[model samples]
Target: MADQPPIPFHRGHFLFGSTFSLLRDSLGLLRQLQQQYGDQRVVRIKVGRRMITVLLKPEETKYVLQENNRNYGRGRSYKILREFLGDGLLTTDGDYWRRQRRLAQPAFHRQKLALLADTMIDEAVSWTSQLQRLDKTQPVDMSAALMEATLRIVTKTLFGSGLGDQTTRLSQALNDLNHIISQTVLNPLRLPNWVPTPANKSYINASGLVTDLITGIIRERRQSTGKHDDLLDMLLRATDEETGEGMTDAQLLSELVTLFTAGHETTAASMSWTLYLMATHPDVQARARAEALRTLGTRTRFSADDLRAMPYLTQIVNESLRLYPPAWAMSRLSLGPDQLGAYHLNADEGVLISPYLLHHDPASWPNPDQFDPNRFAPDRSADRHSYAFLPFGGGPRLCIGNQFALMEMVALLGQLLVTFELQPITSEPMLPRPLITLRSKQPIRLYLRDWPV
Candidate 1:
């Protein structure tokens, strides 16, 4: 066991080690580590008493997440997720995760997703109209607005139109939950949930509100005889092929919470960031709006096919995802001794994969910090590694809703751009803050004027 060569370690304070830097600016620290230690070797660092080996290359990420995935499982943070989100696919692993994934997979298929296209576009158009009515003199908090809009779409698409009134309540509760979860994860000094802290009490109240609302919705659906043809309907009707079984009520609750939270949050972040980029890069925004105007000419409503026709718009979405992926970092704990590229990992050691770092690697992406959506064009991306730009992750655990997210982003962006000219209120770039998802540390304020007819 001791014969294997030791992994390289980053020098830090002897006592706290790299804990302060990690707590202060993990994103910056990760980028610094990648620069100090090139892609050829794995870099190890200690935070508090725990040790994590950072994977810098695409091959290493692919190995841990795909080829030899069985040797590595989700890390400890997932337990915090399970505590809040229940045993949904995002938290559970092994056979249970597989079963959940299979049952939920069918709901997100392109064919099934097509059924909800109108709902998505309609929501975006409706939200756009609402934004148009706002006083143009004041800057709108785009981050908040996008979250609200995506929440509306997710609720309608998930539970059919019946939950329209619940969106506001759900959105508020989810916002509180996100803040609580972020504090718990990032604050090393956070107290235990059982300690009766004010934050803990708030978390409990928010969790209860969400649980009750969802439970009541599910209850009403089970009692109703009519079919709604939404995700919930499909989930309720889903049956496991092997076991000939279905998800229990508790299982349904967990999955609904997961989809409702994950479904909207990530897409909202992507849209917010993309719009920020578009506001800052007028040429790119003009090009994208031109593409949208051409394809969606004089139409108040467009089909999924219309979204498929915008290649340049799709490129913009992909590049934004590369720069600011919602799931910026993934963690896994080795189940046993394993070798990742040239380094050997001990059992129970933590492995960290940062998509943010991979996307910014100058070796893979020349002048990586620039906002060039053309980098995603077919000719340029032809030879790129599959794992190098994983915004939704890679391998079997890839986000089930990736296609759905892309379609929604394209729909929302297309709808909004055709109607409004996005103007950034400030020149400062929005900083990324790692939370339940990668989010802007501050609200993205934008002033939108009607696009010239």
Candidate 2:
């Protein structure tokens, strides 16, 4: 029942709180407390005018994200993201989020996913085929390679046929955007766009590039005589429930940016980490490869139904996500006074939810650091708190494209691992850089052996 402020002695003035260090080493600070303060309800970290409360337990995390979700709002990280992402669901709250969520929800429906499956398999084949062209002695920088594959998957899913290399252009633009954002997220004392810092200039340039690419696609679609069977068409034709009108050009651009960014970035990171882990662990790799090879031998294509049948493949993915979820941490703002377990939170206080910390909690996960896919076995998983594992988060604000990301990974990883052996050329363990997404701090190099390395 000890509901007090977080251990508040960082190297900062009392009134100013721990501003710089909070930005520079956020997760480091949180994980430091995770082991020593087991089951502690809330620990407060002061940031500027706000007392940021960090939640470590599943039950408390569940209450903020789900049961009392109404009393919380999207907080800091998202607010900073708004500068680049605009008013997409990730940044907006209240009625607009509901409307946009409803309008875009159908794009990721199970039926819609089936439509995208053949294309996904086809793209995977083409991508891996090119890798075969590379000399085996030449190690691949998987971080970049995965981003290219994932960006194409997202674009094809949304735009369908007849768009040539637009996905590549968009990918480069987003890559530049990611670098600019990394600096912004890491350095809390941001210079405004007018101040003309190098990062600010890069962001403006990247933002313009994204806007131009999306607007061009919209213009081309409008000029065409036929309706395409893809997300862009669906979005173009969607009508608001009350207004009976489609989205404005600005709204369309915002949603396009949101979906395009969200759909690919995290999935690519997850795939990269999963591949790195498998490459480093022979037994884990063999087991996953066995399931995939059995499921899809001598076949280049994987149907949507194939994903459902691969239990071990699914478990491997679940475990990789446990270790390196791309959306590693989430933030929320208190809408009003509230109590979570024994801790009392004030109105407008920022709350930090670190799934990266929760997934590693030894109290819930025995031998937490070890990689074991069997942790996701139905019986074992059922006994754990529902919120104990939140790679895609939970409740009403759960990632809308969770299924899309899962389906993409299952199809791509299951098929690719069967075709190629990912031999890690990077050191024994990879280091993570937590930013807009969880990414490898350095290029994760892996040799793409034809198999049985």
Candidate 3:
């Protein structure tokens, strides 16, 4: 057997017998697998008819995400996303992704984002207004509230108009769509739009609503001569610098959907976790609140300039992302054979890297599970490798909206900390659901007591 060709480990019977088992406790299972097999172990697990290898170690993750990125494409997991995103930056590969990234670059520039900061703060105020009316004695679903807030900000920033009446309906559709994509990973059947499984039906209907909303916005923008300079306006006016060609309506629609889905959902999850952490860690919360008050004074409003000046607030956001990265696991299919540490990865094989695992790894992080924002402090920095905390990912394909997401998060959190003292409702642990993004399986509930100056 030692001289014979090595067989990839097949724990097929165990996996097949427990379809829901892996799904139910995925984070726990991945941790156990990494501990037992030491990072590079190859195990075959079925996703419909196909088998996929789940890579756990940081070294292997770096190679797949950065070193050998060319050897991999975005892979099959993003197909459903493409139905909504339509060859947008996240789903496309090679030249297509590069082109979209270039075109979309200008809108996300720091200067442009600085201008959008006013809009973001306005939306933040609108969000907190709803919470102001909530009774301090009542437990509120911070996750849902954060989702609504971030969605409003992203939509307004992207479209320059309130989503208005469509807000609740669109929010529900997005929630359903996210659920379907995550669940379908284990049951990968490529059914047509006509097929009627509850999941598939939800996906089709939700995607159609999103697509229609985007199409209407695009049509209105095309007809108007006004220059709003918002993201949608910028996208509408963008001509390929080289070819002088604008994105097709379909392409534009896809990107709008992608932005709405990727841009909002992840930010919402990150803020929810941040608030939960703040609630559980009162000292940290007090420090953050003090910092916000010191920076903003008695002002009810904060601007981008004020947000930039708040370093401690930035640390809280960074630490929250470290603990619960929104885009938790990333996968790529190898384009050519390559050497990854001690193992030989074959061309066409799928490679997976989970930030959820790497962020909590004890080897890289001291007191790995502790909620310590000071780890990000300049003087006592954790002194880890660059890829160790890739909540936004890395390389050329690093998330384009990283700056936008961070600024939005810091601005909102800073504002909230000043207005309310958050306290956790349940002592139950906040379990993570590894879907399209890392999200809390249960809504993060918090008591929002008004802060007295």
Candidate 4:
């Protein structure tokens, strides 16, 4: 057999930077590559002296995410997740992932999620009320506030009552855990799980506390005669239609952790970015507010049904997601040799599909860098390819919580707009730091201008 031509590799100045610099400035580096090579260039990125191939194109993204999904499995990027999530849906591949997906699918059923609307709205309103109490003289970190709000909603929806004080501790622990995971990704030394470095120890302790909380919730729900139709209850009662097998306690715990982590963080970041965008782009904000008022009619609270009725609000959220997909890039390892474009992919070689690059491609989107919610209008969206806007990704392995996240955003946005007028505290651009999810490097500082109403 003839030897295949070597894939073009670009070695640049940034490749020699410190490991922390490479980790912290990853998005900037990616942007530079996009400019130099255009989308779909295979560049060699250095992470602590290790060179990893980075693929950035929509066609390649579709090939990796949809067409050859089974041939690829979640790669090294998810190793940090497996420690805490324990081979849950997001980190697992092959038959294990398939089985877990089947077991957890019913909990996120549309009808069940519809019931969660009130929980989402209540949490949003509660958080907004706290924000409103802040003195207008001071700036509020809307980023942190949004994170807390989304965390509360997901926690409540998953575990039901008695989480008031526990939620605060859990949120702080999770935040710390997220930071540790991001740091660990940059340092590639293989360390035993029980090594007990300060960061690792913290993660272990946090994981234990969270697991205990989830187990207690499950036990309490099982013992109670009162019916709570929330997700945890649904997960507990869910039986596989094919084999009638139920998820074991450990399986359920792992999934609960996955949902709490993946579900809340991404939704929080999306909503935070949406608010930041709204603060900076007042005109678009006005349109979103007008849409909410027209559909909701001065109501302080919105329901799932009301969210469904607000189409423009949905578009605004969709547009925000396109600009800053929470899960900005996804990675997979080819199980066998395959053809991707003109390049022949090899087994065990990693492939990455960055939604960040695809959604911002100038060809797919005009004035790609600009904030334009109108791009998501029915007429405009109809002209685009289906894979062009993959905030929750495409194909079977698409985020199971996609609908739930959308609902949470709509409910939260509806309440936020009606309660406080958001103003940017600083004009600095909210730069992306692509860790577990894409997050702003600094807190999204904003002034909570009181609504005249």
Candidate 5:
């Protein structure tokens, strides 16, 4: 065993190792890894007592995420999210995760989320209309705009009655949790969750506010005899086929928080990147707008059924995801010794898979640097490997809300393009920040100009 050649190590400070670089600019570090080590090499990243082997190729990702999926589980960073999401599907393992997946699976079924498309369209309309209140010449922070809009759609879809006026309060709480957790997980002196230090207090307070809000909604729903025909009702009615048991209040709250955070955050990030791509490529934007108008007719709001015919719009969205997958990197812990390519991995070792690297691999994607939506054109995509493009991930644990997000994006973009065209307002280039989710380090600024009918 000792005779096995050593995997390449990313050299760094003796004490901190790759810790600072990983937190500061993860995408850059990943690209550097890919450039220096190629796709298959097992690269070592150690800081303190922790070690992770970065896996950048698709086949290896397929092996861990699908082929022998049971041998791996969610990474350590997920512990921070468990503070907010509890033991929901995203953070659970073994039969528990499988059971939860079954219960929530029916809620996001194709026909069900399809019915919620009108709700998404209505929400988009309300948000788009608010643009009138802003000065057209002023640079709008589209990242915040889309984040707020998607967050509203996700909450409303689950609760039937949107966040309403509590939108600001809930949004701020979530924002605080996401940022605090991402930074806290890296802090060497981070206190325990139960501690009353300033940081701990803030996380607890924000988490409690979120908990109270969800609990109130659940209690209200339980008292009602009428059916809402929404995600919550589906969940409340779901029973374990094996035990005939239902999720407890504590369980339901965790799942609710998971759905609330994961459902909106990734979709919003994708939409932000999409807006930037559209602005930078005027021709693609104009053609996409024209196609959207042509298919949508004069209607201000489009339907889920309407999304089926818009091929170009799908390409645009697919391309954006290729360039900037919201869940840029995911981690899994190996349950046993295994062979990943030529490297042997021991039990309990952490593995990192970067979709950002796989999607841009020149072998799989031609001229990967260019923003060409045609790469997703039906005929062109037919020959590509399924794992090659993983914005929503793949395998049994693929994002349950993928279809919902795609439909929601279509509704938002379709409604938006019908009345407006997005134009880039900032001369600076956009940079990706790989936190809990990938986000722009700086605001993705743009001007929304209304177009004639």
Candidate 6:
């Protein structure tokens, strides 16, 4: 460890290092650092005594996330996530995570997800109906609406459509908890979850509300004789193939919380960003809508196959994810000393990989900043590096709900475009807010006008 060569680093404040700039504008500082150290595979930034090493190229990213993935583990941020999420797939590592993932994996199978398609399209159509009734002159908060819609879709698909009024309650409680988690993770001085601070107390209340609602539903489902065939039912009946033991109620709670929170949050952000881009780019909007209309014709309901058929609409979603990936920046802690690209990484040092950076690399993606859906068109995408576009991340820990999120986004966007003409309320572009997921700093407001029937 003592004999290793020093890695190149970004210079920051004399005392605090990159802490101030990192907290103020993380993405901007990262981009700046990458440019300052051009062609360097790995660049380090010191935040006080801690050094964060960011992989700069697609090859390095592929190495860490895929080729040599076993040497990396979930970082400290995931430890903070476990405070609220418990030891679920997103938070756990090694054997435990593998076991839980195995138990829950069947629920996300294409056959199972196909059964949930109608529920997703139904919720999206219902949402569009709500938009249709609203005054055309008023600007709608598309961000909040998409969040609510995705929440409902996840809720119904997870626990079934019986959650009539609990949907809003769960949505509010989850939002509060997500906000607290994001703040806690980002704030270096944040108090422990056990602390009696107001923020901590508020977090506890929201967590309790979510727990009560989910547990009550679980208990009811357990006592019922009928089957709903939802994710909850699959989880309830799932057992370990090795031990033949099933998840305990407590284990179920953790997985449920993980699924509920992770399921909708990122997808909603992606949809919101897509809408923002569509509103700003009328040409893209027209083309997408035209494709949707031509594909669906007069039908409002869509099947998974129908969604798969709309390649251009899928491109728009892919490009949106490329621009504003929900899990924008991810971290992994090195398990041991290793060579990554040109740099040697020490055990326990933090390793950062940003899809945001990779997606915007001028070398990999020409006009990287521009919104070009055709970049994902099959012919153009053939030669792109495998890890260059990691919207759902890569390797074994890739998001379990990736396909489900795609189907929902494409279906919802298709339904929306065919029904309404989205008009941006303001010409100013919405800036990305780096929360748990990448979201708009301001509410993405749009005025919806009924399209010709």
Query: Which of candidates 2 and 6 reaches a greater TM-score?
Result: 6
RMSD of model 2, in Å?
A: 2.5
lDDT of 6 by residue, 347-419 (tens): 9999888989888888889898899999998899999999999998998888888998999999899999988
Candidate 3, residues 1-453: lDDT per residue as tens digits? 234333144353554632444567767766765665554444444544555666655666677777777887887777766766788988999988878887888888899899899999988887888899988889999999988998899888999988889999999998888888777764544566678877777888988898998899999889998889589988887878988888889889878888988878989999999999999999999999989989888687897898799898899999999888888777677788776655565677766667777787776777778889998888766567777788988878888899999999998998898889998887888988877778888889999998765
Candidate 1 displacement at residue 135 in angstroms: 1.9
Cα lDDT tens digits, model 5, 102-218, are: 888988888888778888988888998987678897889998998899888988898887777888888888878877887776554567878877878888889898899999999
Clashing residue pairs in candidate 4 (N, C-alpha, C atoms within 3 angstroms): 40-56
Q: Rate the local accuracy (lDDT) of all candidates.
A: 0.88, 0.81, 0.80, 0.80, 0.83, 0.86
Candidate 4 residue lDDT tens string, 1-453: 157655555655564643454565766666676676664456545555555556666666677778878888887878777878887888899888898889889888888888888888888888888887889988888778887888888878887753778878888887887787877765666466679788778878888888788887766766888778678888888888879999888888888888888777888889889999999998888888888878777565776799888888888899999999998877777889887776676777766677887788787898988888889889898878777789988888888999999999998998888777889987779887777788888888888888676
- How many clashing pairs per prediction, in order? 0, 1, 1, 1, 0, 0
Among the numbered candidates, top TM-score falls to: 1
- In model 6, the runs with Cα more than 4 Å from the true position are 1-5
Q: Write the per-residue lDDT of candidate 2 for residues 151-174, one digit (tens) a residue.
A: 878888887753466666667778
Model 2 misplacement above 4 A: 1-17, 162-169
Q: Any residue pairs clashing in model 3, and if so which?
A: 71-335
lDDT of 5: 0.83
The list of candidate 4 runs beyond 4 A from truth reads 1-4, 13-21, 39-41, 44-51, 298-300
Error of 5 at 298 (Å): 3.9
Candidate that beats the other on lDDT, 1 or 6, i.e. the better one: 1
